[model samples]
Target: LIQTFEKNNDATIRNLEAWSLETGQQVYKINLTGAILFVQINTDNSKMLVATNDQYLRIFNLQTGHEIFKIKNQWSDAQKEVTITPDFKEVISIYKGNNLIVWDLEMGKVKATFTTDNPLACYTVSPDGKTIVAAEIFGKLHFLTLEDKE
Candidate 1:
């Protein structure tokens, strides 16, 4: 399953669409509020993570289009990037103040936080989900290895 977003007019329509490659059919669609900044599907493709301009990261069940939970930004700025771990246990978000936060999906609590000197330009989790590479606005890239908790 593949997911994509669509924009309508000036409003950022958060359309979570799942397309079938075999038949070219849209199997599922979930519309969310706020201007979406980022969207990521869990490794198992059961859930989706969406970051919007409303300073919140929301999780939704793709199969039922039901929202599972949302992580509201504690700071004044909104989240810039978000991704889910391959194990589908955690969600990582980079806030506007260069704050990197790891959230436990099931527990609904922050697992860890890292402060950076420069604002984050972008970030990507490694395919194996053991590491994360984030680029700062000053053009410096930082690599972080995630520790296994259990």
Candidate 2:
């Protein structure tokens, strides 16, 4: 698994970098000023999606160690979760611990907002985007449809 060890940087992230899980070789690195909330490897393995407390879900080119796209939030709300679509084209994240944000990975902007009975503490999406299974800490399951949630 490609894991992001949150740097000790309470103010500025100093030791955040990428490493290959199989070989343990340094893949790439970057600088940041907040905690890493998410890291997702693309299907093609060319890049990864990173969500930081700085409110930017950045797509980094693994080969060059450069950011290709950045989705910056207009509000400084605390970003909670980040997930990249199976096709590696859409970026989804959570805002205010309750709002689900669908971001166009290439455009880096919000495309949709979904509301649930409770905040989306954790969620999983099928590769085909047909089933979205989510769970909160209330010991219940939240079923969602295309237009309405139940």
Candidate 3:
């Protein structure tokens, strides 16, 4: 199992802890440079993606506890949500509540960007990885199709 450790007073995340479910022992403890805002495990569970207060996205190897890559978030907007694509080749994130960003994992660069007029509250990609459904803060939902063309 995976869990986050935090200080009681400020309730800020301090580190990430992964424990063995079978042995009930601590597996690894990864120190964080900043409070973790988002955490995601890839499909195979070998890699972990974490977004922190430092405005960077970090990918780590779960078994070795070593960093695989890091991507600087260029936008100053707050990251609302993040997810690894079904194929684990890209990262899709929503920033500033309306900006959708797709980052290529291998290149550690932004692959595409899209924006909506209204502030988005949440979003999710279809299982087939060809569409996105985003809901506005005011409850309006928008359905978008994903394409690779630039």
Candidate 4:
């Protein structure tokens, strides 16, 4: 499955669409109130994570075209990137100040926070969602492991 977005003349987001690459048919479409900064589809393709410039992250059900949940950015800065965990149970995001946060979808709260010394250039989560690898602009890389909190 592939997803695409359309923008208006004002450089604002107009809509988000999910398409089937093989059939070339749209599976779902949703209107947006803010410009999208990042997007990620869960490994199972059941849900989608959308991060917008309006300081919000929204998760939607792909099949029903309904919003599952929306998260307001806690920090004042805009989110630089976002990704869904492999298990489809969490949303991970990197903010402007290099703040990495993991949000538990079921709990509707932040599950963990990792501070970085420098601004994060990019980040990737392991397939099992147990580890996160973050890279900085100055050729520095940080590895973080998630442990059960009990």
On lDDT, the leading prediction is: 4
Q: What TM-score does structure 1 among the candidates reach?
A: 0.69
Better of 2 and 4 by TM-score: 4
lDDT of 1 by residue, 61-131 (tens): 87666789987754344445567788877778775568888887888788878778998888888888888
- How close to the true structure is residue 119 of candidate 3, measured as C-alpha lDDT? 79
Instruction: State every prediction's TM-score relative to the real structure.
Output: 0.69, 0.68, 0.78, 0.76
lDDT of 2 by residue, 1-150 (tens): 344564462544444577778898877667765566667778777887777767767788876668897767632445455666677766666666666666667777776777667766687777775455667657556654332124
Candidate 4, residue 38: Cα displacement in angstroms equals 2.9
lDDT of the candidates, in the order given: 0.77, 0.65, 0.79, 0.79
- Estimate the lDDT of model 4: 0.79
Clashes per prediction? Answer: 0, 0, 0, 0
User: Model 1 scores what on Cα lDDT?
Assistant: 0.77
lDDT of 3 by residue, 9-121 (tens): 57878588888888888888888877787788887889888888777889899876789989887434356467777877777877766788888888999988878888778
Show pairs that collide, candidate 3: none
lDDT: the better of candidates 1 and 2: 1
Backbone clash pairs for candidate 2 read: none
Task: Give the Å error, residue 44, model 3.
Answer: 1.4
Residue 86 shift from truth in candidate 3, angstroms: 2.5
Candidate 2: segments with Cα more than 4 A from true spot: 1-14, 18-28, 74-79, 135-150
